[model samples]
Target: MTLLLSGVDSFTGIHPFLLVLAAAGLDRLVGDPRWCLHPVVVMGWWIRRLQQLSERWAGDRPWALRLAGGVITALLVGGSGGAGWLLEQWALGRGLSDLRPAGLLALWIALTSALAGRSLEQAVRSVLQALPDVAAARTALSWIVGRDTTELNQAEIVRAAAETASENAVDGLFAPLFWMLVGAGLWSVGYGGAPGPLALAWGFKAASTLDSMLGYRQGTLLWLGTAGARLDDLLVWLPCRLVALSLPLATGCGPGGCLQGLVAALRDGVPDPSPNAGVSQAAYAHAAGVQLGGLNRYGDQLKVKPLLAAGSPRPNPAAVERMLRLSLRLELLWLLAGLALGIAISAVGSVQ
Candidate 1:
């Protein structure tokens, strides 16, 4: 059972790469639908339900309700990981090879939970296509980002889209993989197999949910959401930097420029209010040779934030396409790295 679990974790770790390939193929075969229901969507649905119930039960006590909601949200997130562990155990006990089609299928589902890949690209593209003339683009961008886009010009629209894409690359792509690696390492040390990749997926989803729901600078929800947001920030710290570094490596930005971009991002990105998001946005903005970060709306509220990167004039539609292409390249690089690591680990274990 132990060997099987370890083998499964090692084998299934490559699922991210395979899934990306599959999704890309799917994208090419059929055009992207504007609305795809992700696993996180289901998670969000349940979280909102819990929040509503909490509010109902503790109508007079906002603090109590917020606390209850936070606790419930954390449990759901952590429980998803435990559930994955059990599933891995069940699969191992059934004598299914870790690399079998069934195992791969499980991994694919788990990777999909990460919510890092194609959907994000499509979302940005949708806004870009609708921009400058379409009211729907303003609404769509409003949904994805906290920025105010009510009176945004074309350049501002492109900057907002680019910024959101770069930030999500950290949260959606790199963070889940970081947790997967952590879970895999722990699994190897103890039970000899990591839980299904879904464990990390659920955990990240939970964290993301909490961050979104309660991670505001003001109001009663601040303290309650602090731990989740901080933990998320810590988990993505390295991965965020890696995402930033990829900007230079993939975009032909030299090391000197990349470092400069990194420093500039670290110094300037801090002004955006999100602890970790600015780093990647700043890096990508510098690498792409465009300026990012500016004033925008969060609902009806206007947030005037400092700019992250200083570069040429505003981005046009072509620049939007370029950013997407760069993002795709970075995604591919990360997927390839994951697969290689998985293969190497499996080979080493086999020899041992």
Candidate 2:
């Protein structure tokens, strides 16, 4: 089940847990630097190119379009994972000792590139900062959400912003973090020949990008995007649940609050079409004591989302701010938990 690398165990002087911490810190400090061609951008480019190619073959045949989509999904996911594997191999080479500074830096940058916590925060905050001027706020919100923002009132604007912040917290941060940790654990436990953190993270990113761009329920995308959308849903399912459960603890809420949040998330999120977004939004809505979900417009197709935290009040800028802060707190909580687990593993190894 695992691909054993050539001299896989030869790489030394690097720990993925440490890299995760370093990456999180660097991401918080610098956000995503746009000076370089970002990995997500590359993924987007590939999606566009591949989709065009698919169109040539698919034509007006629904069945053919669906088949082409599946092929494209396989190619993109495999390609992204392969890219990650190569990057790590190039960095680790025979060992970190040989590459030293360059190797470590490369590993750190690669891991950091997978996270978007800081960027998510900045984006949500931008909407808040542009508030009081409804139009400016709408413009800011438009940058982050797919919903039509033109006719939104102040409350709706705030609600949309909060919803996006919560949903993306799962998509942009926790999901990738979860995969990276899994990849790190596999590598650290001596599966070096297998896909490492970057491989898993980038693979997830590719799926996510596909869903965002092509996974629609209407028109041509209805059947063509099934594979990509389902793939993303599967990848996000566990992480979304984990985030929902741990969010209360991250906010320093006691057992009672945690239980309530989980219950709310399940009750509200289960009914939504998406396997993940509803749960994420519900958890944040409960945690922040704000209601979310209502009528939304995506390019003139009006859709109504199920209300989350129905008993709660509409979110304000302050509520949105609380959610952002909670996201930061949750990030730290998970990191600390990972640190503790790493130490326990080390202690057991020493005993053996």
Candidate 3:
């Protein structure tokens, strides 16, 4: 297990934890630069291209669409993961001692691109900034959420923005962080040329991208999108729960209060159809002392969600701002915790 520390040094000239921290900092400084071709945009293009091909091949047959979708999911996820592994190997081969500055920069940029904390915050804040003016707010909110915003009032706009911010805390931030750590742990155990951090992070991103684009219940997407949707749900499950448990504590709550918060979040979140979304939203709802989850419109359908933090007031602009702040604080907390764990692992490996 000497590889824990030594391999990290050789691979990136620093600890993976530090790389992640730097990447997150970079993301905050410059979110998905508008001038450049973002990786997720490329990923979305590929998904659309593949969907066209799949539709042509599968025709209208339900089983055929399902099969085609499964194949597409496998290919996209596998290809994304494989690309990450190859890029890492090519960049850091024979270790960073060789002093490949371009390679190191590339790795940092890739890592930064994978994280969406800043981007998500910016989007939500855009909606918040458009507040009180229902038309302007709806226009801004339309860009971030799937709900019909045309009929939404100011309070509903605030609730929708709050919900988007909370739920995406899992998708846009925590899940990628969790996978990168997992991959780093695996690499330290002597798994060379395996996923490692970047590969696993990109892979999770690919799955998330798939679900966001194709995972719908309407028409052909019902069957054709199942593979991507389920894969995203599976990948996000552990991270979502981790966020639910830790997010409350990050709010400066005492141990007993943290436990109560988790219990309350779970009690309310469990009833939502999504395994992860409910818990995440509920966690933030309770932490912010605001209610979330209510009627939402997706295209032509209107759906009602179970109320979380039932006795609390509906989220206002203030509550939404608090939730965003909480997200930022929680991110810092997780980064510190991950760095501590990495150090502990390295120390244990040194002893061995």
Candidate 4:
């Protein structure tokens, strides 16, 4: 599906490569623009409002919570797609139905806002700069990580930052792109046709946001958030493995080293706690030359997860930067690979 969309006759009406490059530039220079109007932030606010308003009526009942969650998911995903379609139409109309400056700009904004590579890097860099002051670093890290940072040492903080950054390479970037591509082909052939990449990417974001907000194992969210969490896991499963498999080639790590690290990751990664997180974390831990997945604190509870790359040294500030670099490599590789495949698919479609 992704291949078809990415391959379709200008799936976005803009050259895929040019559109992606523009989006990347946007990510680097304006990333979520702390003060600017942000789509995700707006979605988050709406989700929160809907959930709270429903809670007033749903109370603590499992069915009510679950129902509320379902409603939230539908609203967010549907809303994003509708909004994308509307924007695309406006852009296309303004540009005389051609993918010129106006349409291209709209596409660029949608794709750019969907990515978080720069923002995530900036966040980890903050922790790195705060350094030696574990307290300051922890405070900085807390914004990015969900784990308790109050008792963490410098090493733990760096590890969390690196791990999150590496894992998010897929979440904040690839997975959404994958879906956008998948939707492209469908949009091209569907009734009335649609401008796909933007709509699909935002739809993916809706799912991810829902999982983050409601997908918890404790409290009312335990039962209510189950659907959101599972949906996120299902959508991300393949992308995680894909990223893990390519981590070596993307980072330009030698086969000998990558192979060795992959062995460590397979032995340690597949069995780790998270249903999907370990897949990416394993390759990242090995490629970044850092140890991950030891004991982590979540509030008063301490959980000891399966360790990865046990032979490597503990993560440090250097490891954080290295991991971030590796993640970038993975994102680029995925983009290029997808583009290549898309070209082939588009050719195939044309022949048919």
lDDT of each: 0.64, 0.85, 0.85, 0.73
TM-score of each: 0.81, 0.95, 0.94, 0.86
Span of ten consecutive residues with least summed lDDT in model 4: 4-13
Residue-wise C-alpha lDDT for candidate 2, range 184-292, written one tens digit per residue: 7766665667787888999999999999998987767887788999999999999999888889997778767777778889999888888899999999998888899
lDDT of 2 at 264: 81
Candidate 2: regions farther than 4 A off: 1-14, 94-100, 255-257
Model 4 ranges with Cα > 4 A deviation: 1-14, 93-97, 183-195, 253-266, 345-352
Q: Give the residue spans of candidate 1 off by over 4 A.
A: 1-37, 57-66, 91-103, 181-191, 217-220, 253-258, 346-352
Model 4's number of clashes is 2
Clashing pairs in 1: 5-193, 6-192, 6-193, 147-297, 148-296, 148-297
lDDT of 4: 0.73
Candidate 3 residue 142 Cα shift, in angstroms, is 0.1
- Tell me the lDDT of model 1 at 85: 64
What local lDDT does model 4 show for residue 285? 86
Model 1: per-residue Cα lDDT over 1-352, one tens digit each: 4454445433333433444445334443343343655666666777677656665676646677557755765676777667666655554442334345675565545545565556677778889878666577778788778766788766677778888877886787667666665555444333335554456656776777767776675554554455666666766788777666566767866667667656766887767667788777877777667777766677677767677666566666677677778877766666566567656655676687
Candidate 3 residue lDDT tens string, 1-352: 3332233345421266777888889988898899988888988999999999999888889999999889889988998887887666666565546535787789889988999888998999898888777899999999989888999989889999999999998999999989987876665555555677888999999999999999987788898999999999999999988888888777898667767777888899989998889999999999999999999988788899999999899898889989989988988988888788777777777788
**Alpha carbon lDDT of residue 51, candidate 1?**
59
Local accuracy of candidate 4 as per-residue lDDT tens digits, 1-352: 3332232333432244445656766787877777677788888898789878878878999898888877877788889877876665555442323445765676678778888878888887998999888899989999988889998887778788877877777788767766755554443433224556677778778889988988878988876676777778888887776666667886677655556655666777888766677767887888877888888888888988788888789888888888888777776766676566556655666787
Alpha-carbon deviation at 203 in model 4, angstroms? 0.7
Ranking by TM-score: 2, 3, 4, 1
What is the lDDT, from 0 to 100, of the residue 323 in candidate 4? 83
